[model samples]
Target: MLKIKNLHASIDDNGVLKSILKGINLEIKAGEVHAIMGPNGSGKSTLASVVAGKEEFEVTKGTVLFNDEDIEDLAAEERAHKGIFLSFQYPVEIPGVSVTNFMKTAINETRKAKGLEEMPAKEMLKLIREKSELLEIDRKFLSRSLNEGFSGGEKKRNEIFQMAMLEPKLAILDETDSGLDIDALRIVANGVNKLKSKDNAVLVITHYQRLLEYIVPDFVHVLLDGRIVKSGGKELAHELEEKGYDWIKEEVNA
Candidate 1:
């Protein structure tokens, strides 16, 4: 459902344009989970942000297409309206806004963008309850302020909860496994797996293979120095886990 072609991007660092993503070519069809594994500064998150239309980075070359349409010029909000959901590495907490209320507003706004009316209160409440239960979230947790003072696990789970409610066609999870305990990681991955469908896709960007154990990927890609250096199936994750990225780096240099 998403295609990126020779995508080149750079970020301004202290007034100097430093390249990050250099000629990244990837295609993710519907009903597939693609895992991007790389070391620090390999441009994994950069790919996610550029795809989601973050303006901080400049796309000097290449194109990003969603459902066969060019999205390079689309703003971040517009991309989101087109069913692109990005789970941030560090989710910001909005104080004074309860999670329930925040989700209500967000869903309504997305509906409005699609020329639809506000969801009925009853339907919204029902969806909230159902999705919360799907994520094994306590109802009382929904009443807490959005992400405010939440532990790392809670924040990540909340991100997935929002994903469930929004039901985006393409969900890009950037470093979602960071800071999560084994149990928290399982719960989050389980929620993601339950929500996956033949009509949607997931792109998981992570540093380690542990997350892949729960959210098994259809494809495993190793990104290095702003480019995807290798691509393989799920077994690649185990290989990387046992050998670490050093072998991959050696292969790249060789």
Candidate 2:
């Protein structure tokens, strides 16, 4: 459902370009989970941001096709409306905006784009309650400002809740396991597993194999120095976790 061909990207406006993605070619079909594992500064997060149409990075080459349409030029919100979702590594806290209000706006905007009416408040609340329970989030969180004063684990759970609410076609989770304890991790993984379907796909970007044990990916890709140097199955993650990324770096330089 997603195809990225010969992708390249850089940052900043002065054209002092440092390419982060070097000729990336990847295809994520529907009903699959793809795990991207890499060391720090390997461009994994950059790829996710680029696909979500984040404005900070400039795509110098390559095409990102979503469901057969080139979406490289689409704005972030436009891409989101097209069913692309990115769960950020660091979720921002918006003071004064209740979680319920924020979610309602996002849901309504997405529905409007699909030519559907806004979901009724009663239905929205019911869905929220169900999803929150599944994620083990307290109902009181719905009344608070998004991510405000929430613990690290609570923030991650909130991100998953938002994902459940949006129901995007493609979900890119950037470091979803960061700062999560074992209990929180299990809860988050269970929510993701429950949400997975034949029609939707997930791209999980992480550093450790611990998360993979909970959410097994169909494919695992190793990125080093801004490129994918190795691709394998679930065992690759185990290898990386055992041997660390230094060997991958050596292989890349060789």
Instruction: Point to the candidate with the largest TM-score.
Output: 1
Candidate 1 residue-wise lDDT, 78-156, digit = tens: 8998999999999999999999999999999989989999999999999999999988999999999999999999999
Best by lDDT: 1
Model 2: ten consecutive residues of lowest lDDT:
12-21
lDDT score for residue 137 of model 1 = 96
Clashes of each: 0, 0
Runs of candidate 1 with Cα error greater than 4 angstroms are none
Alpha carbon lDDT of residue 238, candidate 1? 96
TM-scores of all predicted structures: 0.98, 0.97
- Provide the lDDT at 115 for model 1: 97
* Candidate 2 local lDDT, 120-157, one digit each (tens): 99999899988889898888889999999988988898
Cα RMSDs, all models: 0.8, 1.1
lDDT against the true structure, per candidate, is: 0.95, 0.93
